[model samples]
Target: MGFRLPGTRRASFATKVASSKSCEVPKGYLAVYVGEKMKRFVIPISYLNQSSFQELLSQVEEEYGYDHPMGALTIPCREDVFLNVTSSFNRC
Candidate 1:
């Protein structure tokens, strides 16, 4: 699987909150990509506050024929991971 980093085209909210240092999803959540079958899937890292990881899993199941999304998960504050995340998405 390939890890796509968020870029300058990321969501406006994300871009504003993202400092020059790194990017972090508000509320401690992170987004990641996982490969299933022959395609890649986007999933929030750790777990969403109210959206629970299970919900994402269910979406993945319905869309990708898989019940789980897997990939390297890293929290905010980690410069490397943050940078990777920032480079993955597009900014408005």
Candidate 2:
């Protein structure tokens, strides 16, 4: 899966950086930055409806409010924790 945020595009070192081929999220996917390094992850939009995921969203709201420094949804958690939580979705 590809990872990127809207509006604030990071520079790519790849040779083919087309202006038209920007980071556009697929219809049912959402992009979020996680951890202090702000690593980006693209996940299914359906995850938002899950109780476990909603709890994480709550933490994000409490910490960042609407002012996300990354210009996209940011989840304030360790990368491993976020991965563990999201990986569980595969079982459901």
For model 1, state the Cα shift of residue 5 in Å.
19
Residue 86 Cα positional deviation in candidate 1, in Å, after optimal superposition: 17
All candidates: TM-score: 0.24, 0.71
Report the lDDT tens digits of candidate 1 across residue range 1-92.
12332442434444344322343344544544333222222333433432434454555456556333344232212344333443444223
What does the lDDT read for residue 72 in candidate 2?
A: 79
Candidate 1 has what TM-score?
Answer: 0.24
RMSD in angstroms, all models?
11.1, 8.2
Model 2 per-residue lDDT tens digits across residues 1-92: 22223333332321122222457766777677788988766666888897989998888788778788878788879887886777566552
